[model samples]
Target: MATGDTMQLVHQALRENSLFARLDAADLERVVQMASVRELAEGEALFHEGDLVEHTHVVADGLLRVYQVGPKGSRQLVLHMAGPPESIGEIAVLSERQHYPVTAEAALPSRVVRVPREGILQLMEERPRFTRALLRSVAERQFELLLLLRRVAFFEVQSRLAQYLLEQHATLGPGFPLPTNPELAALLGTVPEIVSRTLSRFYKQGWIRLEDRRVWLENEVTLIAVAKG
Candidate 1:
């Protein structure tokens, strides 16, 4: 597409995103002018942990996976799967942090709006509501991180897997497409083999049934009991 058309698309996306909804026409125009579009292929890295924070990104299309690689490169933990209209790296931008805390990779072919940090800071100064909204977004993400940490620290692999399955079922129904074992392992902070074994146990316990990529819940009450363990 033409550059003008691309900018128009980006502008419309920004307007639709709740984080940018409060901006007036002129402020929104400033943001569009300062923004650039980034297209990422599947499994491509957008930014790595410890990279200098420069642009605050918003996913305009497709999914981005936020993760952290362990010290010895032995493990990767999936922190978040961000989709359209979701802001990435906002915490670093808001906190004036120099580096990103997590790596962002494209889970699918993705398009992101890259807004310069200066432009975001300008918006915060001129738009009080925008600042509050950004802070709230950060706080919400922090709460989610806390909950995830609690689960990882206290829950067993089986319990965490059960909870994840139930949550996915609730959101996407019983026939939800389950993520691959490796992906689930990253999300649950375990290895793929353990994830596979847990799923097998679930199947044997009559808590869930898997066919191809789809998962069906056989007994939600029992799954919930397992999850609460």
Candidate 2:
């Protein structure tokens, strides 16, 4: 029942994804043949916090925000983005848990392939190599999350903000427009006005030049000190 275009996109998504890279054409075709694509709308939740773990989804396009419900009845944003081939409910896959730990919401209109848990487990049982590769992917994600936790726990907001800016600058290149004050705040897990005040102080001290959303590191040494402190 899959359309030609849907099949093509699934193939393209799998091909680009590191997780599925090792799958031979025949295996990849089998996966595509078995998976189901589900469409989600903006602000719509794919799963509620504590929902039974039915399927693990891979974002084919758009974005997903993973969050938990706070005691105050607020949504505590955990991860702002989930892109293609990044699987959700991966931990559930390992533990054989019946429920998910957090709610997953579509940040924008999105398409995802929902792989049933039983099907995946069966595949892994039959293909040990595939299971090994999948575990590696999960471990990598765990390491990255640990680093994020360390940042939140040990670093002061200004220092964390500076380090994040430096990272973005490295990826986006120097002379690229720095992120706007608000965007920077979100990345640092803080608010815009506070970020503005901190950045303004740094700007006056000649540590950085912020024009728009781009940050140019005027003094790498000072910035490193800031990140460290």
Tell me the TM-score of each prediction against the true structure: 0.95, 0.82
Per-residue CA lDDT of candidate 1, range 1-229, in tens? 7898889878977987778878889888889988999899999999999999999898999999999999899899888889889889889897756999999999889999999998888888988999998888888889989978989999999999989999999898879988789888999989999999999988998888999979999999998998998
The 10-residue segment with the lowest total lDDT in model 2? 73-82
Clashing pairs in 2: 177-213, 177-214, 178-213, 178-214, 178-215, 179-213, 179-214, 180-213
Each candidate: RMSD to true structure?
A: 1.4, 3.0
Stretches of candidate 1 above 4 Å error?
none
Tell me the lDDT of candidate 2.
0.76
lDDT of 2 by residue, 48-150 (tens): 9888888867888987777665688632536445777677777777775688888888877988877778877877887777788789878887886787778
Score candidate 2 by TM-score against the native: 0.82
Residue 27 shift from truth in candidate 2, angstroms: 1.9
What is residue 141's positional error in candidate 2, in angstroms?
1.6
